[model samples]
Target: MTSATRPYGTRERRRSIGSQGESRGGGEERTGPAASEGQEATAILERARAAVDPELRAAVDSLPRRMRRVARYHFGWEHADGTPAAENAGKAIRPALVLAAATALGGPAARAAAVRAAAAVELVHNFTLLHDDVMDRDTTRRHRATAWTVFGDADAILAGDALQARALGMLAEDPHPAAAAAAARLAACVVELCEGQGTDTALEKRAPAEVTLDEVLVMAEAKTGALIGCACAVGALYAGAAPEDVDALDAFGREAGLAFQLIDDVIGIWGDPGHTGKPAGADLAARKKSLPVAAALASGTPAAGELAELYARPHVPEDPDDLDRTALAVERAGGRAWAQDQAADRMSRAMDELARAIPDPESAGGLLSLAEFVTRRST
Candidate 1:
């Protein structure tokens, strides 16, 4: 395969800049070449999470007692026993994107103004995760039993609903001048997310051969891209950026989110269970119409036919050999290759969109670094 066509693990691509400092705030600055882009992105995200977590916690705490406990546990803030645990929480990528976009458009001060928007995005993201776990019948997340598995389906769903309401409530109650527009944008994004999910569930009922790449990509963009875009746009809105600039940032986030989802699909099939917090071949076992599987099924290659036959089996494969065969079939059908190409292409296009918003490439270094981290991270 050519450089652009090669799969994710094949080679490294140098596409963006890196950071050197722990703070994006006023601090000792090193201008020259610094840490790896991945490390910088991680540092930036850590900082963003630290800045946003308090506000996020406050929002979650505002829920009813039962819902709050489930939300707290789901957020890795407490154990099932109602005890505090030093457990892994989500990466907070959505909130980080919001903050980074704000800083990119205005400055570090802009992040403070946009914090509510950041918190709202994070809440909505977790809400989706809670509902998604139930819908997918996923038993585990973040290396622990999913909320639905531990709290029962009704509570889990109710908790998710509470988070969604809280997210919109935050935006609605914000004193920021753009709060109304932000709320409207977020509400629309939720609608798109639901429609995308409906499409996904519908796809699951159809024969694999009947699904098209376009359909899957559209679904992925809606389910994943919409919120990320909204997060970025809200940040720009909070910063008082022009509508065109907001639109550009939204486009940037949408493209990056699409790339992120594509890589996630790849990880779903091939990632280490220990690292990914899921079983090997979990998406395949569920027969999920993930981006890679859809690509493979639509490839029209001989391997595609065999893959379809495997998927057409009466039940999900239980034998290790059968599961292995299914994975191999996806790769042989060119699904893996197609997804990798699309991810890279989307990342490149995301850069283009960022450029449209922030003319100076240096101004967008933080956002670019985050985008690189999303599309290039190992897990």
Candidate 2:
């Protein structure tokens, strides 16, 4: 799998990065490269959450009471009972990208000015998550019951629609000069996201051999990259960045987002369930044609044939042996390495785009940290 880290998720860390950095040798402690990036990214996410939460809460509060209740539960701000619950909402990755991009070009003042836009971007991300959960029939999110399960499918779907509307509404009401442009970009991104998701669903229903790597990559970009790129582009707009610079930042984000998805697919198959929330092999059970599985199916290796046979029917969680064999087949067929290499390549491109806009390494540190966090060496 690619060595990328996670971006969005406020799900509790079963173990801390600090624990990884514990004294491994002499009394002097040291953090590995991955742990260091995790620490920096964690700091950036915390700051983003602090800056964006008030605006986010205010937008949710404006919803009709029923939608508000659903939204609150989805965000982990309240329990199903409507009682206050201080669960982690998310890690604020998209909002952090907004603020980081704004700060990279326009500094602290621009970062402050972009908070509302950041909130709006975050809202749209959660909107996607809600709808995604419904469409995917996902039972767990952020380490708890999905909104659809707790509130019913209709409420979850309606809340997702409300969140999307409120996100645009937030942008429309913003007095900032860049608000209009940001909203336009975000709206287009939402359309791209929907298109990608539709393509993914369509691909999953097809026989595994019918899918192609390129098609899956394009769909992944549309489903995942579009919003992340929009977040950065929106930030660049908020910062009064030149059009070319905005485009560069958008490219940077799109590439990084693709890398993030590649690693996510890897984790879906092999990551520790305690760390990832979702059970191991769940993607295979669902027969989701995620990137690695697609690559494995496309490979001409003998294990590819084995994997295809395994995927002919969904692997039951009760049959851990079958799931394990399927995962091994994917690895043996070079799917894991291919996905990791692609993630690294995408990140390299993202860095090039980032450098095109902000030449100074220091100026790009926050965004860099986030990108590295996204590309963590989990494999």
The numbered model that scores best in lDDT is: 2
Per-candidate Cα lDDT values, in order, are 0.83, 0.84
lDDT of 1 by residue, 1-379 (tens): 1223332221245332111111233332323222376678989899999999999999998998999999999999999988998678888888898998889898878889888889999999899999988997888899989999989999999999999999999988898888898889889999999998889889889988788889999999999999888888988888789999999999989988998898788878876576567676888988888999999998889999998998988434557687789889999999887887888778777777777788776778788788877875554
The lowest-lDDT stretch of 10 consecutive residues in candidate 1 is: 14-23
TM-score of candidate 2 to 2 decimals: 0.91
TM-score of each: 0.90, 0.91
Backbone clash numbers for all candidates listed: 0, 12
Name the TM-score of candidate 1. Answer: 0.90
Question: lDDT score, residue 77, model 1?
Answer: 91
